[model samples]
Target: MAKKWFLAANKKQTDGNRMEAPQRINASDGINTSASLETLPHVLFADDDANMREYVSCLLKTQYRVTVVQNGIMALELAKTTRPDLILSDIIMPGMDGIQLLQALRQDPRTHDIPLILLSIRASEASKIDSFDAGADDYLVKPFTPPELLARIKAHITLKRTRNQAYQAIKSSEELLQSVFNGVPSSIAVYKTCYAADNSIDDFEMFLLNDLMCQSLNRPKHDIIGKRYRELFPTASKLDVLDLFKEVVYTGQSTSFERWYETNGKNRCLRFKANKLHDLLIVIADDMTAEKQLQIKNEQMKAKQLEMEARQQREIFRVTLRTQEEERRRISENLHNGLGQMLFSIKLNLDTIDLSDSLFSTEENRKKLKNAELLLANCIRESRRISHELMPSILEDFGLEAAIENICSQLTGPCNFVAEIEPIVPPADQEIQLAVYRIVQELALNIVKHSQATEASIKIYDSNEGFINATVSDNGIGFDIQKEDNNATGLLTIKHRVKMLRGNIHCSSQIGIGTAIKISLPKTIDTY
Candidate 1:
């Protein structure tokens, strides 16, 4: 029946004068094939029936560049040589059957991807299944419509072209990726995880290496690619970095580490980061030696600068202390030589006079003697007060707390004073003790003279953290801290002294509220 239908198709094509030869059809066939027809997709047709071949060629010639063969063997040879976009074959052939041709084409690497359509008179499910099992892309019965054949050929060719285009794009992308990987600034390497029998990642094999990575390893790509990590780097086992790589693969997490790496006898700091990509591990390495060395040099320079500043400060403090001692010595000398001699002379003259026998015990003369004695005593008391004011001798005789207490007792004006001082254990060094005393003295004087406060208090104690803390507060009218003039001369002097002793001072005040001054000094000063 199929042969009768083919004969009828051939008769109709002959009546229309469209019958073609049962051989290859191309531009060189002298059929006036246009250049556009040559660019059309090529289709290979195989069938033993001559009328069917002519009819199929007449149907497809207008749309495709058709090549007709007498048998599957000829079709396979033509497909292999021409590499047609699609193949159409009849199952029952003389030499190689359509199924056998499909298998052969699928086995050959050159023609494996070409689309194949199997045509057979047997429309049973078994035949169709056999054709598909042989890698036939499509299957059709012998008596099919021309539209169906044309549509099938067009669809297969379109799909094949799409696949080819996609393959070309993928290849281009791979080449671009390889170029970028090699051109990257940092070192990079890829490894494929090699698993053990227990499904655990035991080791890694070198998969890909970039240019910088090759240079860093001091080896070429061919020498390292596909080599086991341990075989290439035996020392890595001792470092146990393989566990890190395994962790990345098993956990699918990224990790990073930094270490000092020595290569070619030079030590360098290298930072490594590993990322998991499916079963592959991508490790990126960066050289941090320059940055680390710069940091170390900066730290050393900063330390030296700090030391130099400390020495300069110590020298300034020493010079200032020496000058203060000299001034005190001069004041002491004046008081002792000039004032002491005058007071001594006055006492000697008074002792030389006998008060009981003076002026024969007359009331006027005795009153006069009493008045002169009171005047002489007043002068002596005033001279001693002046000397004590210059340098508190009580501070030397008694301890710091007692000296401060004596100072508090001397607050004679309207404002009251209180002292909360702790006994210095082991006693502070003389310089610190004096500095504390002077700071308290200056702050106290400032409060009395300027603060117009009715009440004031001074506190001194050990912070128990190697510091001596002092706070002086007053319930007086405060002033704006932002004003420069508000920082009085006495406060400036206190600040200078505190700085020399390596101390910190904080002054807080408000317009209506009182003022508070707190000072902290280190218990031990590092002169060097």
Candidate 2:
């Protein structure tokens, strides 16, 4: 006779229930189900946006244990300590974004295998390219509906579980079915018969039972030895879930559950997995209740943050434009006060010498007059150069269009310059104008200094965005942008200027390939 064995449940060991069930179901299916299942596997999510975290977390919670954190720092700490089964992180965040965090984790052998995903609204083709370049297992674009997020998570989790092979202690293949069934950490009571294959599990059991299998469930050891699990789960006595567990045993694969339910007046919902052992169904469940709520709040928070960021960017852009305009003003003042007057004085003296020559006679005097004229010519050229350097006079009231033409003329020394622009400023935000000017200036300088190219273009056009955009593309030997820039202020300067304009700066260059500095600045009252 199999000795009837049962042990009382222990809730104190649950650490003051700091991780109590997140869902509360009327425990009145009403039996004292003190037999807690095993602890659930841990998963960590790092996303700056609270709302994204909420959606992903809630979806994942249905099947696996989940933990959603605000940023990479918490994700790292959680991964190091709790050693979650998987880690899902969004790329960009406030303190420490996903890329940096992933690098750190990978460096430490402890958290290397954990998978990282970048979740962001930066879904443009270029942005996607950048995210993958930064070392990510996968990338999730922003505005992803809950179903899409859930599907991606499921694919990754399945991959992770398949990759992870925990050592099993069951005996021979003969007892494989029962042994696998009973080996899980849930209060699963698998019946001896089943007709379904491993892949198709009964829908209801697929959900609840999987949650029960995650490690979060707690149960006494002896109570499971001989007692029928339904005895402990009186309300579930009517549930004939035995067949699903049996299928898992026969298939050597696993069954899953994703759901929300409240029991014992305690809210609990989690992801779970069940595999069969010789005569029992080994059950495991995750605690998802907390993760779901957190994911929701997180997503909401993220939405607000994105809106705030957009506004800030607009403001920064406006400030930068104003700054550039001030710079232009200063340069204009210098040209007028110093260079302009000096050139004018030289012109006047030459004019007087020519007029006086008509009244005087003598070869020596004529030669002297010629010398003065030549000197005046030099002064005029120098003044023009100075004026151009301070501020391109063409760009003053004319805006960015004519200024680019001047830049093209100057670059003619080494490379043939091509310039184009649309002439229009709707009192156009100054930041866009300045950013376009500065960014173009820097790219040209870099080409002259490093690109070793002989040709370039400063093209500008306007679209419905009501914004001025510029691109300085050069046909020069390009260099790797990814190379570490310990002191590369040139690129940084360009980037800063773009940031200030609440604009974007993009550089695409590779060894032997030409480089292009593409910039887009919003023309509105946006801040950085």
Candidate 3:
């Protein structure tokens, strides 16, 4: 059978125009060529001799699914269409030799990855080298045993399967990583460092940009990707961003910082965190413009509030001093006009009387003396009344409760006034006691002069928490507190007194209904 196959090959060469029939090898040569039980790896075998095709197919049938092609042309076509797991071809063929076929398969992407082996009759070093150069994965010499053929085929097929699985795993991992990078809320980007002639990093080229990064720059990915930092942002040099990235890369450490930039005529603040990732640098940025603006606004508000409070305090002090001066002036005028005139009258009457006039010398003379004596007594009483009104010594001598009760008894008008004074110890601080007395006096005067109420009540009591609470209410023609001028001298005095004591007061009034004034003062003032 071997001799016949050789004879056919020689005749095919002589018939230059028409090819001779190739010999075929039959399984009847004591080889068990049964079909494989499981799914088998595909193999494409190419050879010009029909006998060699049949022999190789019969040998591999039990372990693999074999496709026999008569020449390299048929083998190449079958390999591309079927995408076989392995290809076995003879070096010598009638059309398109194995070396040329191997080169063609390697160039085509679809069939390039398929494992290929070359079968040759020539065993010279040149031929083996030529096969490998043409991209053959394995080579076998002619007259090789079936065992050797099966082993080589199994080894190549197993290797191809393992390589394919690894490629798939790597692809999947890359896809997962991409998903996570883009899914983050902040802007994330990857950059490749570009170095100058001196081996120092001069610039950076954008390698990857997530969706948020693209949006933050207000540019599309295609425009930003593969572009240098300066190209994307003309002002990058001023920001010194290249220096920051270089520092991180050189130190192999992570750093975070804040940066401000102007984009589309609006200022923006960004907080950036950078770290080195092997040959690339990764940056994550958050937009802090809104937060920074809010902080600035809050600071402005606080400053304004402080200024207003200081102004109000100054105004209160000025008003208080002015009110005290006006009270002193009015008191002085009253003393000079009222008591001083009466004293002059008494002096004149005494001067007219005789130095040693006998008692009852004449009826008219006695009457004049009695009248002069009465005038003297009246002048003395007037002087005492004016002095008491000025300071109300009752407050210092009898305590706050007695002073309040005495003031209430003096309220005589069309209104029926009631005083509910709780018995309690006077405050230790003279200033506190005076403050409470003045507050009550102001409220009672306001109700009597303005309120025109039929009934009025005054309440003074000590709280368990070391506070004095005073309330004065009247059923009068009430006034709208909101519409009333708060800077009125009377209300201003009340407010200033309350503030001085570090106390609080509330005045509630409604037109034509009633008015209620509540004041709370601490028992002791803090000196410090």
Candidate 4:
């Protein structure tokens, strides 16, 4: 009088309102599944009771391709060949039960990781522990509801699929990494430290050498691998590479350096990077011979260019000193010729104009006195002109603008000098101001002396580009700046002054057209 038990099938109802039959499996023929069920995961079930097997097959067939066997012997035999996604078996049977099947599955390499669930009529804690000890992934007591059984089955199947996917991904990644490590252009090697009897590092034995390493060293892998570093390169100590390897191993700090390596009678620059990996040292090297050669060539060119600039500057300095000496000689000549004669004549006239002399008539004496007074006035004007030429008094009193204006007014030649000077805040350094004034003075005077122009103009302004700009131009026949600038001492003097102020000068002139000289000085003193 045992109760008959059956669970309703979960398969979709057909047009005739009947459930589909559960799929059957054979060891030789495999599962006899429909085309629609071909993609479902395979499930293997083992139990001695016919009712339990029938119920489970019907319950799981809708979601899985179900295969039912009589006991663990059949289940284990089929699992070895077919490799189902999951297995469910009843624990208690006549012989070859679920516990024994699980042990066998766990021991087999092919079935070790398959998800298995055990079922038992006896719900004792001892039975559950025994099932788990036998390597069952999950345990279910008899008379469990269909929902609970299906949920457990779904979770285990999903977990197994996820784990398989992860394993495949990791395997593919390792393959890709190995391919890159072998194929990279840089040379790579790994070395394990060999210790002497005293426990101090004696040498490093080659643990790994990539293909590039062998090619770079011009040695085959068989010759390089497992060879000690000192044995491979007797001159490693001279190169300092072996010492760097030891430092990285002892201090656990990475080191990178470049060295000249001699190979096949050719010297090449190679850059090496060494890092410690536990008890091993990893080194990567790159051929930098070409880059290093190019860098050295550039440095040589730069040095040559700097030397030429220095020579030019020295020449300018020599010319500047010579110009100052000529200027002083000219001033001395002017004083001796112009002022000295006038003063001597005035002294003679004063000596004759003594009021005690009776031979001197009133009108005659008045005239001689007037002539002496005119001579004295001429000497005073000559002295003042020389003082102004040395350093303009107006410049010191009124800054750069007023100084330029005074020079414009004093221009005595046929050229009409016009000034357009902006009122700017004077620079903190008086030397800079003096340099600017001299530049303007040289340009204006050169226009009058060389350019036979009727009109000349000068402009000075503070530019928005952070510079003080000055320009001088004339409406007269001009000369080739390249040809004349080097020859003209006046222009040379202007250039020297401009250079001292760290300023730029541009002179543009055509044969028939007028000439314009423009100079720009940085407002900030340190810009040069």
Clashes of each: 0, 84, 1, 0
lDDT of 4 by residue, 355-416 (tens): 75565566678888999999989999999998888978888898888888888888846988
- lDDT for every model? 0.82, 0.63, 0.81, 0.83
Q: Identify the runs in model 2 with alpha carbons over 4 angstroms from their true place.
A: 1-384, 423-427, 486-489, 526-528
Model 4 segments beyond 4 Å from truth? Answer: 1-186, 193-205, 210-238, 243-256, 264-266, 275-279, 286-298, 350-357, 361-369, 398-401, 422-433, 484-486, 524-528
- Among the numbered candidates, top lDDT falls to 4
**How do all models score by TM-score?**
0.45, 0.34, 0.64, 0.58
lDDT of 3 by residue, 1-528 (tens): 434645554565478624323233345653334443236788999888887877677667766778999888988898889999999998888879999899999999999999999988789999899888888999998766556788899999999999999999987886787789889999998999999999999888998878888888889889999999888777768887778989999999999999888876778898999999997999998999999999889999989999987897888888778888877887777777877776777677666766455654455566667887787787788777777676779999998878888778787578877889886565547878787787788778777888889899889888767778899999998877776584462887787778767788898888888988888888777631
Residue pairs that clash (backbone atoms under 3 angstroms), model 3: 23-51
* Model 2 poorest 10 in a row by lDDT: 1-10
Best-to-worst ranking by lDDT: 4, 1, 3, 2
206 Cα displacement, candidate 2 (Å): 35
Q: In candidate 1, how many Å is residue 1 off?
A: 5.3
Clashing pairs in 4: none
lDDT tens per residue, model 1, 137-163? 999896877767878989999999999
Best by TM-score: 3
**Which 10 consecutive residues of model 4 have the lowest summed lDDT?**
1-10
Q: Which stretches of candidate 3 lie over 4 Å from their true place?
A: 1-198, 202-238, 260-268, 287-290, 324-399, 410-416, 423-433, 452-454, 461-468, 484-486, 496-504, 512-514, 520-528
- Higher TM-score: candidate 1 or 3? 3
